[model samples]
Target: MKQGIHPEYHPVVFMDSQTGYKFLSGSTKTSQETVEWEDGNTYPLIRVEITSDSHPFYTGRQKFTQADGRIDRFNKKYGIKDENAAE
Candidate 1:
């Protein structure tokens, strides 16, 4: 509730450089670039390296890796033999 002490919060456009996806939102971040939005008005353009649009997790391209020799060790320790596993 203070005057002249808060950063300017206004409509800004976040652009994903990788996928060329743009979304409009309110932010206090300042940018040297500007883009004309759908309303034919210019707003601050912030170029981001990765957004949810292009991220692996959001795009379902995420990879999960199991530690080398860990699964075998666990199976041996717990005596959990795979039914189809070879001796």
Candidate 2:
């Protein structure tokens, strides 16, 4: 709580580059670019590649790999045969 020891916290706009989605939040980061928000006020613009708006997990477009067990995967990779597997 020391004075003049903390960075300035101000409202900033984070934009998802891929989806063109914008959201306003507070951040200590600064940028040379600016954007006018819905409230008709300009805020510093920060561009990011991925955000919850366009991420595969958030959008439910994520792909899952095969559900192979550890032993099965190891056997397949190096062609190892399990004696118990034959029984």
Candidate 3:
């Protein structure tokens, strides 16, 4: 490890705009804003669109694969399936 050549990795808060979720973690990134954390110590504040709280994958809100509706629509337009399916 070299000295004076490493970025300062400190605790910072990532704010989610849509859900108003806040995540405090350590990073080497820099920010112009700052906010006080639960430790009562102020750190940099970085606004992010997607985080563990708001991201679809982490929150289990991921989009499901569609396999029924589109197939039906295509069958109706091209007249490939039975007539009862059109109804």
Give the alpha-carbon lDDT of every model: 0.93, 0.95, 0.85
lDDT of 1 by residue, 56-85 (tens): 989999877855488888888899888897
* Candidate order, lDDT descending: 2, 1, 3
Off by over 4 Å in 2: none
Which prediction has the highest TM-score against the true structure?
Answer: 2
Off by over 4 Å in 3: 64-87
Clashing pairs in 2: none
TM-scores for candidates 1 onward, in order = 0.68, 0.77, 0.63
Task: Summarize candidate 3's per-residue lDDT along 1-87 as a digit string, tens digits.
Answer: 989998878888989987989988899987999999898999899998877788897888888787568777798789887756447
Q: Considering every candidate listed, which one attains the maximal lDDT?
A: 2
Query: Which residue pairs collide in model 1, if any?
Result: none
Can you give the lDDT of residue 7 in candidate 3? 89
Rank by TM-score (best first): 2, 1, 3
> How well does model 2 score by local distance difference test?
0.95
